[model samples]
Target: MSMHQAGIIEKKDFDVKPYYNQLSSRTTHLKDIFEIYYRYEISKEEKFVMTPGFLNFQDIKKGTVLANSNGADVVADHASRLFMPLYQNQGNDGFFAVRKIPKSFLLVSAFCRKHRIDKLLPLLPGISWKSKDKDVLRVNKRVARVFAKQLFHLMGYRSKTWNKEYLEVRNREAAARYNEYQNEAWFRAAFE
Candidate 1:
């Protein structure tokens, strides 16, 4: 009474024609998949904002009263590039400033990152690699009398903390997860 004895050769003998037919009707477009991946690849910005000055938009002048911090009117000690005057009741920051980065800057940064040029930072007068990985830099403010924070930013170093002897800078690229796409079939398929 077994199926093997009933005349059926085997279930594996079935062709399942519809399955092959369906595969033939469908096509996997690499471009479509890449577009979806590209959509997610868009870079994000890091914003510095304060609660009290959350809504101020006008240009803040130097010495402008920013907020009442610790019962003291927080005044702009220097000229403001942008201003967020404190208007909110419960907030810490008085204002934030934003600027547009040029496309060339991004292009140059990518080139530097791809080539691992940041490793050379340790050769500078006051800069040294924090670890063997060379992902972080320790900057001695005294030795780097001429170097500015903007220069480090241009090379992808950000999120800085200053101690008595050195400024610790972490690479922005290290925090970004762009490497996830490196081994993606869709990413590799484009070149092939």
Candidate 2:
């Protein structure tokens, strides 16, 4: 059954449980299932990961036109119309590809490759304090979810935005200031 698209989460929302549980029949279209699930309500167990960088990030050059004209609304409206409809529907079976990889995965992987860290990569523990009983898996899973959004932000691409060489150099300078902090967190997470 086709459900109204209004109720479902957009492409950025990472919710999986709602849509996964909403299937009435095996043959229901994926989009329909997603719409019904996202339209219903947010669930406690479902995770939402819209990182600030993805939402508020942009790269505009000097002298770029922020167009001030009667046609401003028309341009903005047209862009909105085109993008809104296809934000999550632009791929087959929920997979969008920019190159060989799915757009979602590629976007996230960009950040990971940039940072030299995989955001969605599951963090496997070095040793199990409690053996295979539970402790090791628990920490590994927890670390993965917590770092997933951060890693996704680093690897994922921000559409219509450009991070030029100048900005990359500037960010590198800033990241140096956080060298100790990164060493502590990521190093420990990786080695410990």
Q: Best lDDT goes to which candidate? A: 1
lDDT of 2 by residue, 6-74 (tens): 323443555555665665344343221111111112234433222122111122233433222232311
Candidate 1 Cα misplacement greater than 4 A, ranges: 1-56, 83-91, 99-107, 123-126, 140-143, 161-166, 179-192
User: Which lDDT tens digits does candidate 1 get at residues 60-116?
Assistant: 577776554445565656553443343444344434553445677766766776677
Which candidate number has the best TM-score?
A: 1
Collision pairs in model 1: 50-93
Q: In candidate 2, how many Å is residue 189 off?
A: 32
Residue-pair clash count for candidate 2? 9
